[model samples]
Target chain A: MLAKNKKSLIIFIILSLIGAAIYLFTLSDSFMYQRDIGKITHVSEGSSQRTEDEFKNVDHQHEQKITMIMLNGKQKGKKIHTHNSWSNSGAFDQKFHSGQQVFVDLQKQNGRTTAEISDYKRDTYLLMLGWVVISLLILTMEFKGLKTLFSVVLNFVVFLLFIELDVKLNLTNFFWLFVLSAFIFTALSLLIVIGWNKQCAVTFASIVIGTTGALMIGVLVLNYTGNDLHYEALDFATQSPKQLFLSATVIGLLGAVMDAATDIVSTVFEIKRSHPQIDQKQLFGSGIEVGRAILGPLINVLLLIFFAETFAMGVLFFRTGNSIGYTFEWTMSLGIVQSLISGIGITLVIPAASAFAAWAFRKEGQVENN
Target chain B: MKTISILTVILAFLMVLVGGKQGFSAFFSVLINFLLLFLNIMLISSGFPPLWTSLFSGICILAITIYMGNSDEKSSNVAFLATLAVMVVMLLLIVPLDHLVQVKGFANEQSEEIEAFNLLVGVDFEKIAISTTILSTLGAIAEAAIAIASGLNEVIEQDPQITPLKLRKSGQNIGSQIMGMTFNTLFFGMFGGDLALFILLNKLHNSFGYYLNSKIFVSECMLVLYSAIAVILVIIVTTWLMSRKVRPQRSA
Candidate 1:
């Protein structure tokens, strides 16, 4: 264990060094629009103040002069002065303290350069947290942990590559891409994590069937209920809203379905392995029983995830005096529907996975008995 | 919303029909869980502290979920203790990460949506973000905790004389399997939730670096990572707790 920990620590340090090196080089020049990193050196007392009506109370805002040192770009090591507006609510306002890192946005007009503080530089913090997660995983599960991390990275790469290909091919039917990506993701992840095995095959089948069933049900329900898919809530859609909504549903249901499939398949496989004399019927029954035990909490997991994501918006709506009905309609209706659909998918996967396992593992169980 | 509610009603009825008493209990658990969440939101909006409200609702949801999901008191007790222990550890880890990340409030792009409302609603968005992170991860943590606890409990019951070393190994095996799927669940869930936003960035032609630096993107990434961490912690902690509790008896 000590040797393993030492090796992991070495790897961690090397990875961090590589990350820092990349960050340093990127700071000097990047393909994207340039922004300078700066450290706040000083902050002045309030230079101006304003008051506004906030809900049922009054809110005060103050403007302060901030001095920062440019850490990168052409203006490296230069001291720049900027103005920051701090508000009590901290909604759109950010308060800068001395020694805080910030992104300095530079604009040139009339041959003069003006620097303003755009936002806090959050990369370092994110990197720190990422390292924490990776280290914890490596220390705990060792080789399997490494494999899991590799698969996660590959999943993201595959997703990005799909998007790139879709853009290049000018694919108009995004729903197809969504479905294809979901399948590819499921296959790649299952194959990598579980390797080429019957369990992987069974779980993969269960996920695809479960997700498809849920998608069909979602479509049917949406059509019958006359609930207009709220495309407007998807604030960033530049493509067909219908396609986007459908894609979201398909992608969202993938994880829960995969989770259910894994749970059911693994439990049944274990049971069959230990109790080889058990018949297929009994194995299927046990699979269903295990699924029942887990189904409620699993559904709640998805529900809470979907609902809590909308909590901020929900609170904002209600605080603004919007009626609860209006708030629910505007802020949470989409998430609610999405969660329900995923929940249905998760629920359906139990039987799908149990049946698949029953069929796939039937021969092996009987072989041992014979 | 109305149609979805009606569909939910139908789902509840069908579950009871198909699953019998367990299904009905599950349905009730979901219903009460939703109500508790609603109550939490109401409390947060009514000037209660966001952190406390989140904690309160989290406990209530865990209690109700474990109670309804498990029939016996022993299982429920084990689930609750394991889940709560994991939650406390996650909360401790999150508080510092939240401070370091310092991601608060709506994204800059969301300003257009909130133009009509007062920007300064006197709510501390920083606190809101913390609570949101905690609440979002609570359900998954609880689910994983209960799953591991009950699974090991069954293993122990089957082999009352099994050595602790062997039981621990079984616990690790179960944890590994649970972790594999839960990680996927979390990853895809976040992916699906943010698909539109990704499309938005693509259409706007934002560079990869810029996308990485953007507040919304960073926030979402943090959320995904936080949940993953929580799930990992729950698996390890739940396994350890269960193994310790179900140690082999000497005279069995």
Candidate 2:
């Protein structure tokens, strides 16, 4: 058994290294860069000139070049320079100095790549920082922590896989798929962590009940409120507006709902395990208590993280002299709607998860006692 | 305040204060992460080698993690092993999924607006959009990896002689608790930003089915799913890898 464990460890390590290598290689230059020869064709200030009102007559024509150096690659060795152009919309706003080299993507002109002049001094430092941080995180965590990290990676792959499959198949009936995926995802994840056991089963059931209940409640509330659902803050969405909005609503609530469920079910289960004599009502009460304690703060964290992201847009809109109404209508207001939807989902999940957990534990208690 | 209560409050506050200070490094790490996104966009626009551009971003993030985390050698070594493990899993999952999902392009109003911006700026809006999706997931995945890794290490600190089964069990327990909250973190993290739009859409009196059909709504849904799946897999992979390192316990 010991030898088997060692062999598995060795295999895991070898596979991990290989996977890392592939990830690094593929991600090495997946970004599309634009090169500039230090020239500006157009500039818009205040509200971007490309307003919804003005979009009809928005002149779509421009030409310019900005010179910049490549901050990375074999091209780093060459004194490589290129000319880039801009169109009528106010996409590229900042100007570059002659000596200040910037990072960007190359545009193909007659099979030759040309620079599109994006920005000076790309924040490669930050990317490095992220990796380093991740590295440091794993090191501190040791082996088990390492495994947890691997699970996260695998989960992401699953997400990407499902997304691609849906897109390729063009499956319109995504809601069912989502529900099914949520279950599979939640179950497999918990199973791996908790292993094959009644405890995991209970937790899995709890997560489902919590997430589904919260989602349903959110759906009902949205219906009752009528259709003023706003998601205008999402930048560059340019997709089916209404569909995107609805999907975001469902997806948005899922996390909080799941979280609440996990928290309630696990905490209750722990309580039951530690105190076998604890009755249903007491166990239920403790679940509720834990849920209540965590809910408010969790909501707040979401709010802060979400709101702060829109700060730039808000400032940009306000700076443009747009009325508060216009800015809110087109900018961060959608974020508010998204937030409330999630908040409501979170609120519902707490009670529902706890309730389900209480009932499940009580049933289990009976089975064990019998 | 009563003396004991006061002392308790002081201690609690001190923990927050200390944690806050510690979190600053994490926060900086996050800030640098965002900067990398912006810079990646900028680099793509500037015509650098795409590989080098991404590499630069990755390197930058890596540096910030090292500098700001101020983690000691022992912790760094652990973090490396853990992150490597997770990254490997992330790659295994992400590569295949990318083949499956392809991250559909802007099919809504925002895409047009972005296109207008691109037309004006000569930027490849599609490229930007794809980059954004990838970058967005990166942060969430990285955060989960860090949190799980850190939590596991703390468990080890408490009992070095923890058996493989015991450690695995504990990791799962920890993962379970985290699973509950992390979704909230990811869900609210994604949804909170788009709240007003939902409320407004709700006011429009659209049917539930209709509301779900919006392009932006679908895209966001896609993102949420992506994040959730990522969170779930991370836990599994983490547990699997960690189990290998622990020494097997004898029958008691």
Candidate 3:
């Protein structure tokens, strides 16, 4: 126990120190950027301006008096005062305040220095949130939580590499590339969670099988029926909308599919371990039972996630007087489509999970019988 | 439109075909959930406080998801309470973190799509951000809570005389696996959902430091982290509650 305490204390101190270092790094990292960065040390409201949008509603807008100290560039440590307008909705304009670091556009006229806030220097806060999460994981889970965090970070690296690869390849055959990525993601995540065991292999095989099975059916149906997907409402996606959506669908299915497959496999294995004499038939039956229980929660999880993604835009569409159908068409149609595909994956994974799990245990059961 | 209808039908049929009644209920729960989210959006747009509206919606989702997905009264109840506790903890964590992170409203990437629409929606973008954070993580928290509670319930049922130590170990065992799987789910969900945006950022040649600080990237990262944090908290809360409920306390 003393040794365990010392180990975690060391880990805890290291994580905290890392967090502090990142926080300071974000403050100093501004020098590499061409744009001048500043933190608003004082802010005062200037005025409120009312304007009309395309919807013809009177919008309230305001401005602030900002006194900022430049964090980097030739004007480092120099104080600049400027103000910018903001709207209540902040749809396009932004609201800035004291202690918030921002990217600034600096101007010097007649030896007078002035700056305008361009963007927020938010890396510090992001790192803060990341550290909070890692700290909690460490405090609660100790070394195992560290492993989980490491695995997640590893998956993130792999994902970034996948993205980089897709980009370096210039988006050719993107969907197939993502399908390959799905395999890697599933295998890596399962290997980390379950380690290299019979159970891990079974879970991985079932996830791949289930995901691909669903994709084939989904793709075939989309092709046979002709694509009716709307690409107009896509945000900042300058690629082939269909390809983006398809890739998104494939990756989305990975998480939920892994979730369902793991649950089914773990439950099946647990039942087998606790009851050695349990036949493969009963074990498979029990796996299906576990699948049924998780069915609703699984779909609900996907729906909530997808809806939240599009929820803000959907609301803005409605607030602007767009009908529900149009809003649904514009903001939510693709998300729903993605969810349906994932739903199919979740649905198919159940049988794949039970079948693979029971089969993986069959030889073990036969040996026991002998 | 035609594709959505056909696919919906096929999904419904398959869900029923595999999950049977559970699938049917799952189908309803999903339908109700969509409607609830729709209502949430509507209320916030109509000038309801975004934070309050989303809180109400999160509570409803938690209740409906727990009761509908679970048939056992005890496990569902315990899960509900544990999930609510986690939600409160999440809300506390989110409000301050959101303020510091400053990732509210439409992102810079969204400027083109939303520029011409409107500016005066009479809503708090910051509060909407908070609302979104809360509601998004509700599913994972509730799901983990139900899994742990029900799993522990079964363990106790199997051996009614099990000590608190054994029950605690089992809960940890169950919680740890679920935690790992849930992390995978949230991480992939974030990656898959944001792949398009990442590609966009890469094309823009936004440096890694710039992307890390951007509203789009930070917001997505925070969403995943929030869900993950909530799920981990759920495991702890559910495990502790289960052990306590199952164990009889002696006077100290």
Candidate 4:
């Protein structure tokens, strides 16, 4: 058994390295479409830096003569040339170098084929990184990892379907649209991952109550406050940011909340299973203890992810001499709101789960007596 | 603003009402984490390099999450060490990958909003992106570390005679259980963060292929995958360290 474990570990390591190399370098060869893929062969030197008026900062803009060989399109295998310019900011533009695979629009002008860089061909890199992650998950957890991968993919599909249905059907009342989406996502993910069992049932119920309650309370507070929630921060959102933010809160909070519930419920149920005669009070107490233990780490998880996404923007705001309060209002407010709502959901789910476990076990105890 | 104030009040009230002393501590820790995040942003905006700021705050946040979450000295110490190791590994990986991927700076999606702002604040957006990725993985790492360390310690106390190898096995069991939920949390967090954007993307009728190649989608997926990998790293580190801890005790 020890030898087998060591052997599998070796195999996993070897496969990971080889897979990384193959996926990183050779993925371009596997695509079927012949439209707009090119491999950069040479890049000419860029010009020197120049200062900018805005922000009184140094900005550099230079155009490099990039030469590439087209891997697809009518000009397949033909050499092409284009000028790629970039700057210190590189916000909307980027510098390209040799060995980069980019999608290009082919132009035939004056008996010469010049290509316009459209976007980077990034699917290969994603595939490589994704391969590493999926392999690690499977290596660590085996069958369960496969199940997890399946559940996640299914959830992604459902999410895509939700997007399609909402847009195609032109569904309004985003409150209900997202509320219903939250429910469907929760039920489907839990069912596929954990299956329909007694423990799952308890987790499902607690999550439902916790999510809906959080949603309603958030909406209630918004209504009472006349709905001022820094919606302008969610720029480019076509829908109501209020509904978007609230929906994002529930769905965002659901996973961590579900995790907390499962941990507590499973602990309480474990106690009850081991000691069938244990009273509801003792079991309920255990659940709360478990819940409390999970709170800090779980809350941090939500806080850090949400905060990181906005940190750069907030910093930009601060650098521009925006007041802290003003910066917070514009850059960090929506994320903070999301985190606050999710934090509330996570905290509330615990006691609700603990109480449910105590009740479920007591009911089972009575059923056994009957 | 009113919405946030009300939500903050509601959150404070619910937290205090839930776990009582522990709930208050959890709430306090969250506040500290946020304050640190703000300080981190301020320091970077003032020309403190983002990479160093992130490393400093990352360790501080990891310590807060583990020590405050578990509250048991020995187990949390082990957790902190394990989380630190995983974080260092993640940092090394992220630096190179961030350069290779080039998903830094404001994405095209944010172009309209950022048109008026000056990006030449003398800060490298590439380094800032790395910092953000580093910060994003802390919670997951710290959470994974604490979960495994505490669970393994519990097993050791329960079975004082358990061998190091056996303890390692037990750690794997516990880590796998925690991982199921951790992966879900990370994945759904990604989905939830963009559910609205997804609706808009669909409305624009962008193809799946387009979404796949888009910088925003790739970076978002990369974040989720990186977090997952960090969790896996923490599990291994915590388990190995914990097994050694058990080994010393078993001989004595």
Candidate 5:
């Protein structure tokens, strides 16, 4: 077993290195086409003379001066200077740093070379790091870790596949896609990690009941709330907007909430296994206690994970003196509502997951008695 | 039935009354934390770099974690200290990655949304986009911190004799239990909102390789990693913190 395991480890590392190489190669090529190398000669804070009405309501607008290093060819080694507007936007923030190397878009007008800071190559490299870490984790964990890591890789692939299908095929039926992704991701995640077994089956069943049932509740609540509370402040896509936002909310909550539900259910079942004499009421109470313990932290989990990504926007609002209500309405409100719904889903799943586990194992016990 | 219902109501009322105060404080922590994110974005919009924005965000997360941790004063202070230490460690790990990754803008998909809203309301779309991404992960970071701190506190309480090594092992064991589900939570939580995007991206025959490489996809995935790493860091640090405090207290 040890020898076989070692062999598998070698295989995993080889495969990971290949993936890393491919990822790195693609990254180098993508950014090489549009390079904007520059250095920040001066950094200063400047306010927009333009009202909110000016500049197309960009998420963040920053005035920064950049001394261009080299754009494309001949004078590439030479440092040409220019001033450019940088935003809190992800790409520009990377390019327009002080006294740092940058690659910007160069425009030639009347023999003077000018560069506008564009895409940041750093993002590609950061992503490479994320993948590399994941690969290393899989290689290290060997079996269980590899399984979990594979589940992550699998979900990413499924998500990519699903995204392309929706965009290219232009599937108007958004609801089905939501359901299918939820089912497939949840099942695959559980199957790949936990494997096929009665316990795994129970966990799977609980996840379905817990996640789906909670989702139904969430959908009902959203409908009841009239969707007015849904933060339209988020720059949701307009062309196929409503459907897209709905899908995003559903998919975001599905994994975390479902995972929480399964964990709680299986945990209670494990407790029962060790203490078989523990009765149904005791089992039920244990489930509730577990749920209670996790409830606050779990909500925080979703709230922080979902909202952290958007912190840049929230900070912009407060700094710009946008009213708290105004900021909430557009920026943080939708996330709040989403987190709340997931919270409710998670809270309800406690009972649902536990109840299903209780029923399954009890039935199994009866069969054993017979 | 009436008795059970009444008892249930009373229990909830107490839980809220007890947990409610914590809840309110948590709410404020969240609110202040949100404000900090908005501030970072505005600062970034006004020409401060994302590195600064991320630093400010880190301080705010630390403050909020401390505030939320200190709510109970007596008991929770320990949790708070542990949580704060964990958060600091996480910040050390996560802040560098933000720099290294240099994720600079929102996906093009979001640009249209920003532009449309920009036309209507006159808000700077770029600032809005940056703030949104940063804000999205803050809640998760705080939650993970609390989990690691609180979980470590519980472990130490159960086994006061837990040596430093044992405590670290215990924390990791418990964290493994928590992470078994928590990692999944981070994973699905990320793509959860954009289900349609997944369908669209897939239908277009966007390969796994391509999506893995896409800016937006990578950003979301990294955030998940950041959250997971933050959670792990919290576990390690809190274990250390708890051992320091617990060891002294026991000796005293």
Candidate 6:
């Protein structure tokens, strides 16, 4: 145990050092628009508070003198001075600390370039956080942890590739693309985790059927209620709003459905292993009972996630003195609707997975009987 | 809004049709749990402190879900205590992490929306961020804790003479199976929730690096990590609680 601890410590140190090196030195290439990398050198306070009558009691505002040194692009190694205002309320007003890296977007006029801080260089921090999570996972579960991490990376890679394909193809019918991608994702993810087995097959079938059933239910509810699927809360959409909503619904339900199915099937498999003489009818009944126990909490998980994402917007609306009715209608209504739809999917998966597991396990029983 | 009501009615009807009375009770519990969440948010908006509001609602949701989902008092008690314990620990971690990450408030792109409203309502966006993270993670953590606790209890009940070590092993096995599914649920849920934003990023021709640095993306990622951490911690806590509880009974 001591040696194992020492080995994990060494691995953690090495990973951390590597992460720090990458964060400090790695330079990102500019995208379609040119951008210069800069580090904050100095900050001086200007305005200290908001004087507006309504804001006097409620706002924390600070104007600051900011100095930065350009690290890349044509303005490499040049010093620039800029003004920044920090507001507690505004969306973009940020309080920048010294030594933080920022992306400087420059404009050229009258033979001189003026730069403004567009956004902070935040990827390094994200990488650092990723390292922490990965290291902890590795330390705890070891080999299985490593495999889980691999599948996670693979899931992301697959998702990115699907997004890239969707962009290139410019598909008008996003429903098919999303459905196909969901299928591929479900197959690969289950295969990677559980491998090619009867359990995996059962889970895959249940997930597909469950998510599809939920998607159909979502569509029916949307159509029957005559609810406009226009998601104005989301910024600029290039595709049809309805299509976007549908695609989001499908993607969201996929994980929960798969999770519910996997949970029920795995439990049933365990039961089968322990009670080898149990008949198919009894096994199926047990699976359904397990699903029932899990469905409530699982649905709550999805609902909380969906609502939590929109919580801030809802609060902001209410903070502005909007009525509860208006705030609920405008800010959280869509999220609530989405959660309910996903809940339907999660709920349906319970029986779907049970039936699939029952069928698969029954087949094995028949084989043994012969 | 109308759609939510309609969906709720439909879900309640279906739950009854499928699981009979217990299903209806579960559906009602979930419905009430959602209302509690809605009311909590309303309370926060009505000037209640975000922290207390979250704590209150978290407990209420945990109790309602566990009690309604599991018929046995012993199982519900174990689940509730284990879940609450884990939630407290997760919330403690969230405070410091929220400060370190500093991805609070709306993204710059959301300025237009904020501009349309009064920005001086004096609400601390930092607290809002922490509260939102806690609220979002509460459900996943509670669900995982309940699942593991009740699962271990079921194993123990079947073989009451099972040793503590064996119970712990089974608990670990159960946890391992559930962890992957729980993590994926969170990942896909976030992915699906933010699909439109991703498409926007794609359409705007933002580079991969830009997508990573984007505020919304970063916050969403942070939310995923927070919940993941909560799930991990809950598994450990539930296992430990189950093992400790089973030992005395086994010896007796």
> Of 3 and 5, which scores higher on TM-score?
3
DockQ: which candidate is best? 3
Candidate 4 lDDT tens digits, A124-231: 767777888888877877777777778778878877887777677765676577667777777876776566777678888998877767767877887888846677
Candidate 6 regions with alpha-carbon error over 4 angstroms: A1-34, A51-57, A74-78, A107-114, A228-230, A233-236, A363-370
Ranking by DockQ: 3, 1, 4, 6, 5, 2
Which DockQ values do the candidates obtain, in the order shown?
0.61, 0.09, 0.64, 0.60, 0.25, 0.56
Clashing pairs in 4: none
How many Å off is the CA of B111 in candidate 5?
4.1
The TM-score of candidate 2 is 0.51
Candidate 3 CA-lDDT value: 0.81
Give each candidate's interface RMSD in Å: 1.9, 12.9, 1.7, 2.1, 7.3, 2.3
Docking class of predicted structure 3: medium
In the range B11-75, model 5's lDDT, one tens digit per residue, is: 23333443445544544454565456555555665556655566567656655655563343433
Please, what is the TM-score per model? 0.92, 0.51, 0.93, 0.92, 0.69, 0.91
Query: Which 10-residue window in model 1 chain A sums to the lowest lDDT?
Result: A361-370
lDDT of candidate 1 over A1-370, digit per residue (tens): 9996798789778877766765565444432436678888999967555565645845678788889888878888888888888777677777778888788898877977788877776766566567767877876887788778888889888877776666667678868987999999999889877778878888899988888888888788888877455657765666777778778878878988887788777767665655576678876776676666677788788788888888778888888888987787777777777878877787778888989999976565432221
The superposed Cα distance between candidate 4 and the true structure at residue A324, in angstroms, equals 2.3
**Residue A91 deviation, candidate 3, in Å?**
2.2
Q: Give the winner by lDDT.
A: 3
Flag the better candidate by DockQ, 3 or 4.
Answer: 3
lDDT of 2: 0.48
> Per-model C-alpha lDDT, please?
0.77, 0.48, 0.81, 0.78, 0.56, 0.76
Docking quality of model 6: it rates as: medium
